[model samples]
Target chain A: MSELVHPLHRFIRPSVKYSTFCPGCGDGTVTQAILRAIDGLGMNLDDFVFVSGIGCAAWIPSPFFNADVLHTTHGRPIAFAFGIKMGLPDKKVMVVSGDGDLVAIGGNHLIQNARRNIEMVVLCINNGIYGMTGGQAAPTTPMGIRTTTTPYGTVENIFNISRLVMAAGASFVACWTAAHPKQLTNSIKKAIQKKGFAFIEVFSQCPIQFGRKTGVGSAVQMLEDYKKRSISPKEAAKLSEEELKDRIVVGELVDLEKPEMLEEVKKMKNKARGEVE
Target chain B: MNGKRVQTGRYFMMGNVACAEGALAAGCEFSAGYPITPATEVANRLAERLPQVGGAFFQMEDEISAIAAVVGASWAGKKSMTVTSGPGISLMLENIGFAIGVETPCVIVNVQRGAPTTGMPTVGVQGDMVQAKRGSHGDYEIIALCPSSPQEMFDHTVIAFNYAERYRTPVFILSDAFVGHMREEVVIPEPEKIKTEYRKIPEPGTDPQKIKGFLDEDVAPMPIFGRGFKAHVTSSCHDEYGKRNLIDISALDNFIRKLSNKILKHKEEITLIERDYEGAEIVLVSYGAVARAAAMAAAQGRKEGIPVGTLRLITVWPFPGEEIEKMARGAKHVIVLENNLGQIYPYIKAEAAHDAEVSFLPPRLVGEIQDPEDILRKIREVSK
Candidate 1:
């Protein structure tokens, strides 16, 4: 009998026998969801160029995926992706990074690219803490959490990353958690097809670091908590502010048709050449 | 709507504008920059001109993003560049190191102004001479060209791009505010006459597993994205196939040495010097704006019956020690002239001090070029 292989294994690098993710890490689930999204869309990996910044989530596409991947410096993958998209306007450019990488250090790039409405997908794996650096307090870390750097518990409010990108004029924006892998994959597929800046903020679980700090204890427990707190936008709208205080809003926040940067650049080039008015 | 890549005519042009023209002639498809003094003209020219020739220039949010975009564009199979000054260079050093680590080819132009930190944006100074090589915080080699005039601004930028592509590394055009803002006659050659080079890429349909696109002594063909090579490019220490190898000591060693040797091995071809040191006892070694004063001083010294010569460094980084050493061998005194307080002087001294008395002759003031009289007077003192 022939050996059984997972369908998504085809997207993994042939030389990589195992993943670098820690056991029970949500990054692995995020990785699989991304590959599944591509697989379901019947798109060749060649059609995409994946860029990631310095973080565990960044490693999802770097040495793992069997595609063109640019694993860049800390907090700069979105800036780098702007160039890649401009150079290869026909190819899809996607940026995968952690919350600390995307929201804290790389926030300017994220905001600027969203404002430009550049045609690309930025999947921010919001793990809440800096897991790779051993549970440091990230900008997205919830208040009153005792992290490595915040032993006294964080006093700062967490940033709503999806709302931030949506405010910054992204054409498409969505929020989902790791527990909702099927829906996350569906969003990824739609983001890949979007003609302007598409941002997906995935509330991922970092069981070893964040789980230990937040008393969630394990990946299953974290997922169970996510399932309990997750609410659709419709349900969220009906709830009172006090009642919806801790609930995670999970759904598309905005979807709009806008002029993209590269397409505008093309039109400018044609106009410069006197081929267009 | 004339989309000529090279405007073949003589025109009085600003140094920064000439630089933009040179980049266009060298086939630069993309550029990104932020507005900083002594360098804004380059960005302005590129923004207006690139679209006509089927290229693009993005004014990024900051210098870091500007350089990041340039490196990204290079990996996507485009010749790209970024322009800035000292303050901007400080922000770009980290990503510059990233570009070096991954062997991405791109050009960086620094229109230098006075600074320890944003001191004088409008005044020219050779303050950042050493920063171009050492600012990135790693043991690596870099190529830098020092253009003295508006004409050299046009010429050196072309060389900068060609060297960037041929070596698959970042090449710098180190122009000071004096040269960057100066207006002079620049002769633009026909597009066919301008030598342009593109980075070598793997032959079409080459197997991805077998393609060695990094850490080659001779530059490896770049495995650009969207080419079905599935090229894995990382700023981390990686193997020939662009695989991340963090555990092995030998892999780290090879990563450091190979990326450096790729430039060091071709040093003879990479170094450019204008030699006029023959039959002289006193040699004035200078580059960029100071070289103009040095050349004048040398001519005046000859008329005054002193055996004074000039060795103008056209390519300043990768240190150009051999050229300095060779020039020093034929001289009794090697005097380094610079606008700032002796940045490259120690390096020149290290190379030439063994053979001759090496000393630095700084300009009368930091922002001003060295007066020819000051250089000639220094030459007389050294000769005596």
Candidate 2:
């Protein structure tokens, strides 16, 4: 008989003993899904560089990943990823940040990078509320949800982050929840293999800040809700817009070929150097 | 023309274009910026020049992202830069602080325009002088260079990059519209003649656990990305190994002191001053475009037999107090000149006031260069 070790243990830094996430938080599940995806693809952490911004989901990479990690200012990870990708065009650059980070303050960088079609994988962990700042209302928070900042209930409409990235010209777009870790991991694998700006919006549960305080119930209850509300894009295609309003549309929305930014830049450089017409 | 890294010939070039050429000669591999008046020419030149040299320039959405990208590129083991004006610098302050906190080596060019808030886009002013030093929140030291002419714009930009790389901090090229757009003869030296520096990085196979990548008084080897260093870079207070230590009061103190000390410890090598104040009773002190006028005034004052000399601050931050004190001790009266209403005067006085009487000579009006005749008159009055 041999002692068993966690297969995904090698991906984490030797110095990091525990994750900073709260108990049963979906961010941990998402972390496992990401590490599983990287491991499943037979790629080591050495070839990848992880970038994150300020928030709970941002903590998913820094100090945890045994790779080069850049934990940047709030809402600026994607912008920083642009430079990292440009500098090391062959190396895989990934950004893991939250909904408020990638959508609200960092929306311009997201839209612009997607439009440029730069090669990077952006994992936008959407937990509906600002968990790090004590359950403040976020841009992805559904209307009428009571958060710390929205005591009277949020009056603003929530951002459809997948649709936003899709419209911004991302080459790959997908949505999944923590409840579907297998599918989420599969999408991460696909995103890593894709060429241009790939975005995955993971609907994660914040059991502490976004759970009982907001009436979303316990961690188990939130997972059940996510499992029940998630509908496949194919299945949702058969429903009317009114009937599908409450359903979370899951799966790949767009994945196809396009001229990526760095590839075009290479050609442009050659043209400028008079090496090619 | 596109493939050439240095146009090694003398040409009457605009100060902004000279700066771009200087960056190329300094081996800047990545450039990112947004277009703004007076500074756009630097971006335009770089946009056209960088690609030919197997480098790239990105025109980001805003100044915030522009500086952020430069910092990221620097961590990716490339010498990077960003150019902008005063309003843009305001947008970049937070990320600039991030660069300082993480010890990222990058150059920032502020082709300054008149401002409180977009005050004048085309006119030159030195209003952002102190901003380059103290605009970011917190207590930290910075390195800044003031280039007064098109030639110095080219020369100082190279020096800026060297200081940034050597010190592992953001170095500012503080130019104004008068200097940035001024057309003058700029000599681009052969590539071999230019001295450029690259930041030291840890040996390729050094144990990741043993790598002390940050907070060394003598400047630690940068554990830049993509080299198996597995560096963990964050703005939060940390120890020498780049580990985040948010809980300790002593750790925060070390984080702040060690970063500032990294540059301050090298003050002798970092400070640059041009002095001709020997045997003079009244000395005119200035920097940037205003220094050109100060030089002319001092020269004219000497012709009239008044004992007047000039001390031009080439390296403006770490504040150059020692140089100022030395200059003041030799002179009875010190007059500080600036295009704006005395942005650096208080700092100058703090250093010089104990030795000599210090006075600020603002332009007759903001955005106007001090007339050489008016400066001479002031010199004569002060000497009397």
Candidate 3:
């Protein structure tokens, strides 16, 4: 009889025999979706580079992926990926980071890279709490959510990262939960092919650190909640503000063309050399 | 023996501009910096010149991001650097530690201005001498060079890159506003004439999977990303293959020790000193722009029959303790001059204490160079 192999076996590192995620965690699901997206596009692994910052989401690519990876400092993956893209203009660079790693400390880099229309894709896993640091409240943590840092409840309003990136001028933006694996995979594939700053926020389930405190129940229950709460942008537009207040706005938020930073840089170089008008 | 210039063309240039040109000549392909006084010219010049040479230049959002970007560029197989002042250096301390942890090869130019906070924006001070060594939050050794003139600014920048690449650590060009803003004639050597060094890469067929640590006692060759090496670099305490080993005591010890010993073991080759201590009763120990005044004082002291000499430190970190010990043994007294309240004075005194008497000449509170006459007067009193 033939031996059974994992679907992502070809893309994952052989030495990383076990997943680092907690039981029933969504990180592994998101990892599989990303690998599936790359496999579907038939992209050469040699041309892909993964850049990540501190957190569990950052580990999604570091020691696991077969491709080149840079596990950088906290909240600085986008800034680091900017350098990598600038150095190797032809290579496809991608950043994987957690909500705290992206919006809390690294927000400046995210906004600036988007404003410049730098050519790279960013996948931010918004689990609503700092998982690696034991469930502290994050920027994306919802109001009234109980966390280690917010015993009574969070006082700050949650930041809608999808809307934030869209306003920051990303060429492409989308949101999906790990429950919607197929759609998440498709969105990732499109993001990979986009010419300039693409950002996708994956609303992943953090059962151990986030779910237990918020009364979100088991991992299976959280996935079910995602299925029930998610709405398409078109559907969201049709609903009243009150009706859409607590819903997860899933699907592509923005897709438009603009001059990419690195391409403009090349053009400027040519013009300076008197090769272009 | 005069070496041929790599891109030989002499030009009268500001010290900051000379530093930029020196980086270009040294094959630095990437630079990321934020604009700050005194050091802004380095970024301004690189912005105009880097793209012309097929190199990349970025004006990052802040000093923290600027240094972070340069560290990233280094791992991408580009020789990278960042230029900033004291306040900017303060913002970059954490990332500097990150670079040390990963053993990334890059250069950092700190054109220091007077500061406890934002003390003096337009004037020079050597207040950050110790900060450059201990600013980061870990036990690590860094290479720092001081330049007294535009010519040295240009020359030292090239040497800084060479040392950074050779040792796979962040090397510092610790220039001050006095030298960074000064204008002088600088000879641009031909590209071939300027010597350069690059971090060693793993052999072509070496499996990336088999690799353990990126550095050892002899400093392992750098294995960058996208070369099929799959080099796993992290800021956490890591093993030989760049894998995190948080609880493993041996792994932590090996990693931290190698990070320091790589530069410390080669202290002789890495340290650079300029001395003229023959038959001298008193010596002035100094660096950066203060060294210029110290040199003048020594010359004036000799005229007055004071028998003074100068021991100018070109490479400041690893502290050049051996050279200090030797100089102290031969002289009766050593005067340490700096633009701050004795930042490097203690180290000098510690090295020379058993052999000779060491004293400090602190900066004039009004933010002016210690006048040559003031230093000479101190020399006369100390000699007696």
Candidate 4:
């Protein structure tokens, strides 16, 4: 009896010190949201798997979470997670990452997975700037924003993650802000329950680098801005194109209708062998 | 070096093909990889054998996926591996780093070729020796085994898988293009005597899987899918409960430091070296095909009365330091012969210190074997 209980207490790990995130940073909130989501969903502790690339948000899962986590080289978790999922489809898999990990270094995998609709959930922690790499401008840094990498100002346009994932044909694509805890948690739950590739883009805040440079307010103020700047998903679609030019759309935008990647592969296999129509 | 019966199989094949056969006989159930030279035969052979044995074979998009797939398959309760060479190895560094970081069990075969960058694709070079130890951009330890003849290719590969599953970390059979392409007599491991282990996934399709990977210890139970438990995997540094923590210093510290310490703690079980110390004034240190030549040279030296012994490092990384150090400190001189220029000599000298006079024989001899007479002469020169 004692032996069985002894093993039960294992798997608890500590995390990294001096988070690259600033106080009131939404990435911290997003990280907690994911852990809480895992706790809430009652997913298998041993079977829980997470993978991330190099970034502030990417490090979120690195030092913590005792599940089968892999702190990979930058921007390749999607490729890494693809193997984990396909190799062991019984496990509930997730990829915790930032704009650079998901949209930049790992963008190819993101688009491909969306297109294939592999059975997994992608929690894209899109904190506006590259927080870990000393506030470099990422592909998600909005137009004209100044970052360490872009001192004058970023000339590149930002990638609206959910919109892109939806366009790429993910089976499920949802957007929420880290500040909106209830919505974020709800979307996470839905994503956990979804069969196909469920993509949830959480617009998080990095008040340290991008915020200090642009003279933005505290982490809390950034959350308020997140609340005000983004229109609800339902209303934005109903609004005119001009009304949405500066507005970010936040909601479940794509609830797709298609088979998951595994099923499709199986179908392909059966077809190749002429076992089924 | 031990006189175990080397049962020669009745099959004409390449070194890599025998390696795959050895893997199958040892009960390898899955292979995930993208094919590259010298190493491609292992992948090709698995592609044929896996289906026949009710196993699985997947040609991953690239080396990264191949290793990752093997890691995942291992977690799903299968013995797994991947094979590649040169450039593909550069890509494998990240996940290989992950395997070390997380302590997952699997085999990775790198058929070494000449390369600072594609130096020689189809050619042989042991140049990747240092890179094998320091490749993954971290301070973790590595376990690399080099095989010279086709027989060692089969034997060492089987041994590589065993070591991997035993330690639950990546073990490499660092074959060169020569060892891979050359055909020779190899004793395939009998299915009964060959040892194997699979990941500890949950029972088939039952309850919610609820154990943390790498929680209390350096190792964790594997969580395979369809075995009745839902698993969550991450690339992040995690806790004992396997939950991703955002800022746990101790967790990160323990997880990272445990890498070197774990291998060190099990040094006896992990390290392999063949030493012919005898009454020798000089020693020839080498591995893989080069070691074979060094052995012949040492034998020839004895016949000529210039007492020479050979030390073969089977486990290249986390090198057989303790033994080599003792032997070198007592030797009159040492010579390091390799296919590449001076890569491994520095390591031997570093271990032996200023005690042993050292000499190096490089790859310039190319296609031809190192002249035993020349190496013996160098040994005599160093001793004098």
Candidate 5:
């Protein structure tokens, strides 16, 4: 068993001999799905730069991936990735961060990047709570759910991340869970191929920190819940809003073509320099 | 230095505009900033200039994202900068510490205003002197410069970028509202005459990931992303290979010591001062806008048969302790004048106490520059 090799071993850093993910954590599945997407793209590893903010999901790419990874401060991966994309417009920049890191403190960056339609792929791993910090309520944590900070239950309404990005004018947006690995991988692939502000929020599980408190005590149970509650956008449209309140509407929410920010900046610069009419 | 030089000429330019021009001359290709009073002009200038020069400028969502983007752009292989005021600097502290931790080279311009939280927007103050050095959490040294006039604002900005690139740390141009907003004849040097130094890049094809000791005493060459150097950069304590090492005390100690000592070890090269200590009984210690007042007062004191000299600090951090101590020893009194409630006076007092008596003239009001007559009065008072 020790000699047995994982197929994704080529992409993993040999120095980090063990995974930091907890047993039954869905972060591993998400990581594998992203790796599979990159592999399927037939892109050179050097051509990709993986940027992340602080969290369990942030750790997914930091020391684990063989590609150039920038592990930045919490809640600022999109901003950091913005810099990277602006500096090297040719390289494919991807941001992998957690829901708390994105929708909470970094929510401004998320919406602003969407508004500008900057070219990058953002993988927001939504585990419903702050898994690394012991299940604190996050912006995405459903209302009435019990968390470390909200012992009685959360009072605030949850952020509909897909709708938020869609409203902000992202070129591509989608939501999928680890239960739908194949579809998640495909969405990631399409996002990478997309040219402007691609955001994919992957629903992941935190059995130890979030599941036990939320009544889904095991990873398998959480996956079952996701499968049971998940619905496609078309299917969700058929159901009443009240009936779809607890359901996860999965699949591409928006896909459109727009002028990317960097290209516009280049054109603006050329016009300013009198090199273009 | 590697780029083609633009034509040079004299222009009646505001200090903030000169600062933007200096950045352009020094090869800064990326800037991200959030507008605040006084410093807004710097952003405005960059917004207009960067596009003409084929560089990128972003008005970030806020100060935090502004500096964070600058750090990111620096890692992506561009000379980057950001301009802000006290409030913005306060917001950028966390990421500034991140820049220090990763040893990323960038420049920050703080056109200081009255502080403690939105004190006076239009008024210039030198209150952020100590904050510029110690604002970010952690044990690290930074390079900070203060410019007294529009010309120096332009000159020091170029020096700030050069030092930031040479040291691989965030260098600050600590101009005040007075200098940032004031207009003067700034002689723009031909690009060839403007000397700039960039960070040393690793030899092509060398795997930066395989190399260790990036923060060694000698300082490792920077290997930016997308250049085939697959390096992992983090804000946490890390080993030589850029891998996270949270528990190892020795590695942490080595990294921290090097991060600080790289500046301390080259204090002579980093420290810049203008001094006239000959036959001086009183010395006026000053920086930024207040330095102009002190210089005029010192000249007046000399004309009035008092032996008054001045020590103008160009580089404020890695504080010119040795120069201050030597100057203090030869003088009977050292008077520190600034547009704040004695922020840097304590450092001067600490360095000059045993050798000479130190006096402070804090800001008279929120936006007031120290009157030359007031500084002259202090010089006369101390001399008597």
Candidate 6:
């Protein structure tokens, strides 16, 4: 065996697992935050599983995570991860996919899993574009962005994932950004700690693609844009949709408590045995 | 006196329906699937039957979730199964790997319709015999059974469940569209015996309860999900404790080798290949429904002084290598037959009849069901 072990790079595993991310990519920041949160949640790396779908952000976990990471066929990480988690619920199952992956091709699974509260966590990189597939407009793409599919700027409305997830009956729901590392990490940590379904939509940066097309270059400048263009749920409650034009929303939208599914399964088994739930 | 006769021993049934009944009798509590051609009857019948037995059944929107839901129900401590045809089987490949990795016990019934892609849906075909083994993207062993009749469907479906439960592996029952759709005499057992080797439960009151997913010994330890046990389980390269380990070469290699060997070494107990030998010089090898046609051909050939014999493979996987070699001794000619273009002929060529002459006669559909005339004609051609 080679005797060289780089001590500095060794601590950054899920970090160094990705060598292809663009400099200052928000995906990389969120990726590291996820790994750090895994470290803090007392989860065994051996029981941690990650799944992804098509998109630059989806590619982040394909070869990057040191876990059983699978970059599956486009637009179905939730379905695949649903398999992994349902087949082995004791595992710390999570999915890192893109907005198009969750909302476009796999939208059916997103809401159904949340509605049933399947025991898995889904983290969406809401970069508002299908970056890896040549920057077509995505479901989360804002109304006026100039995309390859929308050269004249989009006419479709954007998706507020937090509101969507809340309406879908997710047990826990939150929103975070790469700009808020500690908060994002904590959100991920809490999501992992939850027993039922957890959904966290991260406003990730796509500097080389979505950002460049929208003239939102300079990683720091895009974040400044995020701060300026984004509004919180509380503020949004007071302001009109017209007032929120050119702005993205932030903050936890819903975090209600409900009975996790597997607990009900346990109760059924007990009931079968004539034991009181 | 009334001259009416009683058909006591058997009742006519569809192959897929029999397989469904077999699963139900064997205590299957969960049925999840999206219906496809040649397999819709099984799904439809189970939808009504499972509820009467106080079990659960759901019609998933597609095949992927159908298999996934069955896998989930299996982990939730229920015996589960799914029924589908070729197109649906293609979508189910991903979770099949997860089942192998996690050693989740479940049954997947494939009522094959013709196709490279949707060829002959309402007709019979045996095209998926190879895909049942290789379509899934991992390296693992499978226990596949092909039933020649509705009676065999009932018998083998129970066997599939038994083997799946005993070893915690995915077991497949391969039936073709003809067999799935054709109604035939099948005696419904008064009550079907469904059996699985249940995993051992965790002892109560530990701060962290331990439910073993994969065992150190060849026998996998039992695990009951949500029984208040805290087990670390995963579908990745895992240790005995079920932790996801990526590059641990020793652990992974040992697991792959052992899991294959643990069942394979006892091939005698698991393999169920039937043979007919009375100093026969010509042997006809067949499986699934074609075996019946081959058997009829062989019997007629024997009457005609051709000295023909038949080998019926009940356990399609583990391929009964030792038994085939034993039966092939002193045989002058062996003919392999199947629905596809000789999918399993190469195995016999590679292992069984390396020294003897081996010929593969590809019959394209259930319309002929492996023509006795075709085998007889091939036998004469080979003899000359």
User: Can you tell me which runs of candidate 6 are displaced by over 4 Å?
Assistant: A1-105, A111-200, A204-226, A233-246, A251-277, B1-10, B190-196, B200-212, B215-217, B222-224, B248-252, B364-367, B380-384
CAPRI docking class of candidate 4: incorrect
Cα lDDT tens digits, model 3, B1-384, are 022113467778899989998998898989999999979999998887777677767999998889988988898899999999999999999999989989889999999997879887998888788999999997999999999999998999999999999889999999999999999999987676789999988876677788654758677888876677777778888877787777989988888888899899999999999998788879999998888889888999999988899999999997899899999998999889888888888999999988988898876663577899899889878877
Q: Tens digits of per-residue lDDT for model 6 on B1-384?
A: 011111124667888778877887677878788868989989887765665555655676588878866766676677889899989989998778777776778999999887878777877778888888888885667888988888888888888888777777788998887778878888855442234345444465433323345734355654544443334445556666565466889978967776676567656778888789658788888898889879888888877778888888888886777677777775778888887777878877766675467888877444357777888888777766
lDDT of 5: 0.89
Q: Which stretches of candidate 5 lie over 4 Å from their true place?
A: A1-4, A275-277, B1-7
Q: What does candidate 1's lDDT look like per residue over B180-281, in tens digits?
A: 999999999988899999999999999999999999999999999989999999989999999899999999999999999999999999999998978999
Interface RMSD per candidate: 2.0, 1.8, 5.3, 8.9, 4.0, 10.2
Pairs with steric clashes in candidate 2: none
TM-score of each: 0.99, 0.99, 0.97, 0.79, 0.97, 0.73
Worst 10 residues of 4 chain B by lDDT: B1-10
TM-score of chain B of each: 0.99, 0.99, 0.97, 0.90, 0.97, 0.92
Instruction: Give one digit per residue, the lDDT tens place, for model 4 in B47-144.
Output: 76665555556776678767776776666567788889978888888888877766777888889886768667788888788877898876888788
lDDT of 5 by residue, B338-366 (tens): 78788788888999989998888875674
Worst 10 residues of 1 chain B by lDDT: B1-10
Q: Model 1: how large is the Cα RMSD against the reference? A: 1.2
The Cα local distance difference test for each model comes to 0.92, 0.93, 0.88, 0.74, 0.89, 0.74
Better of 3 and 5 by DockQ: 5
Q: TM-scores for chain A, candidates in order?
A: 0.97, 0.97, 0.97, 0.89, 0.96, 0.89
Q: Quick one: how many clashes does candidate 2 have?
A: 0
Model 6 Cα displacement at B318 (Å)? 2.4
Candidate 1 or 4, higher lDDT? 1
Interface RMSD of 4: 8.9
- What does the lDDT come to for candidate 3? 0.88
